[model samples]
Target: MTVGPAEARRLSWAQVRARRLAWHGLAEPLKGAGPADVASAMAGTHAQMMSAAELGIALRMDGATRADVREAVWGEHSLIKTFGPRGTVHLLPARELPMWVGALSALPRPSSPHADGVRMAPEQSEQVIAAVGDALRDAELTIDELTEEVVARTGPWAGDLVMPAFQGMWPRWRQSMHEAGIRGLLCFGAGRGRKVTYTSPRRFLPGFAAEEPEAALRGVVRSYLRAYGPSTPQRFAHWLNAPATWASELFASLEAELERVEVEGVDAPQWLAPDASASAFAVPRPRDVAADVPRGVRLLPYFDVYAYRVGNQPPALLYPGRASERVLRGNFQVLLVDGEVAGLWHQRRSGRRIEVTVEPLAPLSRARRSALDDQVARVGEILEARPTLTIGEVTVGGHA
Candidate 1:
């Protein structure tokens, strides 16, 4: 990539932080945005824990509730539940499914982690994906029901339950279920009591199809950069679980639409999508770099998209002070003050009350402490509960 005064630019870490906060709607709650609006803005919300996903979206909007997120997913059919970035379940905007499918389907599949005998062959894997789509074409089936149909159609071998999960073995065909979702062949259906169900994505938007690979690639990259830029190819790769080499080449392919930039304290160069709003490079105002840099207190739930800066450099940059300890554990709920992770927190809920325990790296100012209270109350509102605050150590390990 070419570097020059005309094209090259630099941003103080403060500028990047402020921009990211506003871009993510954490600077203030969005006024008219819906659940799908927030979901699409963040690319998608990690949804292995659906409640956490609902919280992630709800907490971003002005007075939005968990029920609002659920309605978007089930009642309004505006949000789709499917395997998204890095092959994890996510709540993606239904309107963006074509682009997600095209881009995700292009991701290189990881080699099987199972024993040779337990894994499917190349042709068998394809057959399993196709059968999954066909099985759920018209009906939403729970895991067991879908497994029975897959084995019946793809032959008895597909039902071999050998890969141990938590405790018991899971059906062999289950291994390819996520791949089916990425292929736009199937998606999550409404839960049947306690059981999760699977159905075709086509059920929500009939005649859906992925865009051309190149077009979809360009669209998703732009979408990601809009929410997470001024970023680097490596960080982008890590965010989507794509190879660094692939990200580099893809960025190279779109050179005309991107500009290289430097962030204070970052070793390697970064990239950003250029915009016309403020003309050349559209750099942040000088004051944003050093003063009043997006001050606010936010309680981000587990796997919150804005808090997960995948492969970010200088851990101190985001997870400052004691926050690193929590981040290292990998899944503690995050506490953000002034756009940086300043503490770690968790919540427990009873019938009408929520107990929030916060562990700050340093004593908070009266103003920030008050903001924290407001943030906690907002969390309770989203969950429809009364909130009580406690300041102490969190006694749990983290993983996601």
Candidate 2:
């Protein structure tokens, strides 16, 4: 049966609810990869926050000590494997770090200018790795402290070559640490001058290891597909920041575990679990429901993974092309209804009151307007203050 755009656009609330629940409900167990594995699974800062909030995990630091709400879920902080994915440091689960680092290392290096600038020789990379290990032997050092230690050990090489080399070899170093069974759960402790202290390495979670890099990648891919399936290869490639060639190869390698499905009547192809049913495409449920707002408008945080995923796809399911375009400006939060974006909103807090400025992409129907008001009220509850809603002029297509 062909699902037309109109039918897709008219998704029932129940269907939307089911899809949302399915997307965020499952958790992938990391038996051995440690904290690093968890960090690797989270691709960026926004991704990390969303993952943590969804999992009900809290990142906290006291004085000079750092920990999470549930230490048993991961492990103690390991400072050495903190900065990897795109050169940013993240707090990862301890056990799963090794395998995730290994998987990232297995990825082919890019020839892009940025990649070329960051490439390091094998010997130079090894020297920096060893130096870092020595610096953080028993105590955790902040980025600056660790960098200084690397310089002190390697002398002139440390100051000029080692520092630069470390940047290039970070990803590989993470892979090596994972291979050696080191976890990645480094956290921000107290700041000493400009340097920060981190937590020591200790087993945070049990049952994860770094062996079988290929198997680990396959497993991660499987989970991603299951949670965010009915998506195109291009989308997967974008999500991983991987080359198309590599993405296709990875998909081919996992063919036995994945099923290819047509996106209803569209020419687009999606990959899902072999056992996924047709109902998998049902719309998602509302993440939050406000008693005061109308039924249709919902506010979502900026860089919401949902917004990121659907940015380039068919608009029939959500906002029209113009509305989506306005949301892409990346300046404000989003307003969504029935799994589609309807407008943009900006929030300002003053004393006890919160001010909200909204710009709808199109003229709101009476039903949609009522739904929006209810959503605003929910926002008020979250901020612990009443909200003053201000509506902005609508913009259509490229014209305002």
Please report the candidate that would top lDDT against the real structure: 1
lDDT of each: 0.81, 0.47
The candidate that wins on TM-score is 1
Model 1 over residues 22-100: C-alpha lDDT tens digits? 6566777655788887876677888988888888889888888999999999998999999999888899999899999
Q: Compose the digit string of candidate 2's lDDT tens values, residues 1-400.
A: 3333344332232333234323332111223322333333333223233332212211111111113322432334332324334333434444445655556556565543324434445566566666665655556666656657666765544444321343363332333222122223333444467655643333232343454779767755654564455556667666656677887888877766665644433465555543323331222222232111223346654444342343124545445678656765543466665556677777677987978778877788888788778667766654456888889943332111
Clashes in candidate 2: how many?
Answer: 40
- Let me know the TM-score candidate 2 reaches against the reference structure: 0.62
Each prediction's total of clashing residue pairs, residues at least 3 apart in sequence or on different chains, is 0, 40
Clashing pairs in 1: none
The per-residue C-alpha lDDT of model 2 at residue 245 equals 83
Residue 379 displacement in candidate 2 (angstroms) = 4.2
